[model samples]
Target: MSDPTALLQHTETRYLLCRASDIGEGEARGFGPLAGSRRKIIVLRRNGVLHAWRDACPHYSTGTPMAWKTDAYMNGDKTHLTCHSHHALFDMETGQCILGPCLGQQLTRVNIVVGDEGDVFVAGPTEEI
Candidate 1:
């Protein structure tokens, strides 16, 4: 499978992020720099659906990872995906920043396919940084 970071390029690589059941409702988890990229992939389950986004935040010219620590993607109440660096809150469903520095902007979305066996794969090309 390709790295999640490269999904923005629309490549054909597919990297398994996790099983859909690994993340429970209202919880988010981070996976990989994989074998090609330096950014982690965020997988979360909200409202019984799974969503994937790049770990990068859209606030700067070069995007930055949102979490301050391992798997720390959610806000204090676990309601929104948040950039711990500046406390920017993002809507889990749309990846849109609802508050803070990058208001109205969005985190990069990764195309994910969940197999019948429940494995989640990020579709993109695998390239070395």
Candidate 2:
């Protein structure tokens, strides 16, 4: 199994995921299955801040995408990131799984940077960097 934390960290190349304004407060969106990975990159807005995460649930070995459909990365309440596969709930701020199958596990976070012009960019996978 791959180490989620090591998959995409400290890279030079960056991909523009979206504009910061594209995500509304409490909204989540999915970007690419970037750099040959099966999983997409998830970007969400919470309390006026933007966060980026790898869209793979920690329940399985290689991990699986959390959304059931496109851009559906949150639970109904929009209070947490939800894994549709097993209904796991992750804390929006810290990416920690607070409930469901992967109780203590956390989502892999990608480096996200918001420019002064409001463009949101994520660090590319090692291969891309």
lDDT of 1 by residue, 31-129 (tens): 997886878889998899998888888899678888878998999998899999899999999999999999999988887889789889886553521
Worst 10 residues of 2 by lDDT: 4-13
Q: Which candidate is the best by lDDT?
A: 1
Question: Model 2, 1-129: lDDT tens per residue?
Answer: 976666454323567789998999999999877676777888998998888888888899788888988998888988999999989999987999999999999998888888789888875453421
Best by TM-score: 1
**Which clashing pairs does model 2 show?**
none
Each prediction's number of clashing residue pairs: 5, 0
Q: What TM-scores do the predictions have?
A: 0.84, 0.84
Candidate 1 ranges with C-alpha deviation above 4 Å: 1-13, 126-129
Q: Model 1: number of clashes?
A: 5
lDDT of 1 at 71: 92
